[model samples]
Target: MSAPRNTAGHALVHGWKWLDGFASFFGAVVGGFYKIPGTRPIKTLLHGTWPLGHPLHPMITDLTIGGYTATVAVDVLYLITREPGVGHAADVLIVASFLTSLLSIVSGLTDWNSTYSEERRTGMLHGLLMVVASLGFIASIWLRVAGAEQRDLAIAVGIVAWLVLIVSSYFGGEMVFGYGTEVNRQAWATPPTKWERLDLSESSLDDRKPVVVKAKSGYPVFVVKLDGTVYAMGNTCTHAGGPLNEGKWVGGDRCEIECPWHASRFCVKDAKVHGGPATFSEVRFEVRAAEGRIEVRAR
Candidate 1:
């Protein structure tokens, strides 16, 4: 179902559809950087794949947004009270906002690198708006630092930055609430609870190659054999619903399955996410060789 069209947010995202070309081009450039050798660890850390097991961008954004919001509020107080200390507090908040926004931009770029199509476009628009706001705030800080005479102009710039931040936040919401970006692909999956036979027989399967099979529940299962052991998990990737069966086995030591769409990796044995853009783990299942066929059930 589409989101409600009655709101101005819907209009804003839809009206900006012309920006898709630029978004795609810029996203590809960022995507290429992450694909470079020796960048996986840094990308994975920014993705918050291992320790946090969730996207780091959204978490850090809270601090960035809060700092800017506080700055706006304090600026308003300065206008009302005309207290020198109140104006100084606003300046400090702007500086803090600028610093946190830099972290937000880095983490946001890491997450945005994997997006495609409409999600990519919306994300790029959101990111660009944030960059502009950051720049505006930086200018505001410089003005404030220059002298007391420029304080009023600095507050005006800070207010403009806050407004842009609000608009960008709306697009960010559209990406999540509308496009389901960063959402668990199998969040609503129903794994078979009973022994469900697979369509393929034992002899037809190949080692380290993923095969997609459907259970009695109609949910897709990814089946693979490695080192004489059979493993089964959700066939749909938790990141973007990419077919896991189409991806290749990666990490000689880790034994991970890398999603073809975004390179998200999940451990073959436990289905834990070993790399991201994927924050959630694939749902694992119990499998067995029975009557010349492989059968699986929910664990």
Candidate 2:
């Protein structure tokens, strides 16, 4: 019994290693296509509409998991009972899951590209594994629909596909838990309650140009004055900590500021995102004027 158990454990380990290697190889090939100069235009087009900052990955993952689980359960029952209706229903769900997985991959990659250097490699790995898992599930579904005489073979494929999905999920968990990927950077921030004076007695800030100022906590804050109203927000771009003070302001009243690095735009009034590559809003600070001096405080 001990010998058999040890053999099973070793086989599992070996299979996992092989799967990892295969995923890495294929991921590199796919990633190369995405890196091409011509692909940039396509990526930009897709990312422009994608909600990169709203935690789309988790939502996608949940949908994929639900669909896959339902498909697996239906497939298992179909195999055991030889029910064609159950198999047909499972086919529909499997196809839906595959399509969802493809969209998730696209959205995930869009966010991954702008991530910190420390997170890029591991995130690439996690995404690679998920792609492999998706492909396996697709193949399994194809084989099932092909009406193969040996139903057992289809059942075996489904089992393998589920195993791959499980492993890919584990890698994704590591990317979030260990590396803090997609976590809100401003979650721990405490905004100032009292408005601190802005030393803008000089005419330099009178033009309503954006300026960077240090708060009492020494954190950099971006300030802009429009129509006698002063607006302040965190100077750091929530996407990649790019200098928001240096970003270009577009249009009037809308207060849209676009990040120089990734072109992520945010509204000045509510700090809400107006464009892609940044899903989270900048931290907006409250401000007022007292005694001919401009003052701002965090909300």
Superposing all C-alpha atoms, what RMSD in Å does each candidate have to the true structure? 2.7, 7.8
**Model 2 global lDDT (CA atoms, 0 to 1):** 0.68
lDDT of 1 by residue, 56-125 (tens): 8788888889999999999999989999999988888888878878878887888877776556767888
> Candidate 2 lDDT, tens digit per residue, 1-299?
01122332233332344345544554566567766867644454445434444667778878887898888888889878888888788888888988888777876776566554334555655676677777778778778777757456666776687778887777676556655555555666655557787665423554458888776776777778766667778777766567877888775654888888777787877777676566678888887767766677777
What TM-score, computed on C-alpha atoms, does each candidate reach? 0.90, 0.75
Clash pairs detected, candidate 2: 53-279
Report the C-alpha displacement of residue 62, candidate 1, in angstroms: 1.1
**lDDT of each prediction vs. the true structure?**
0.84, 0.68
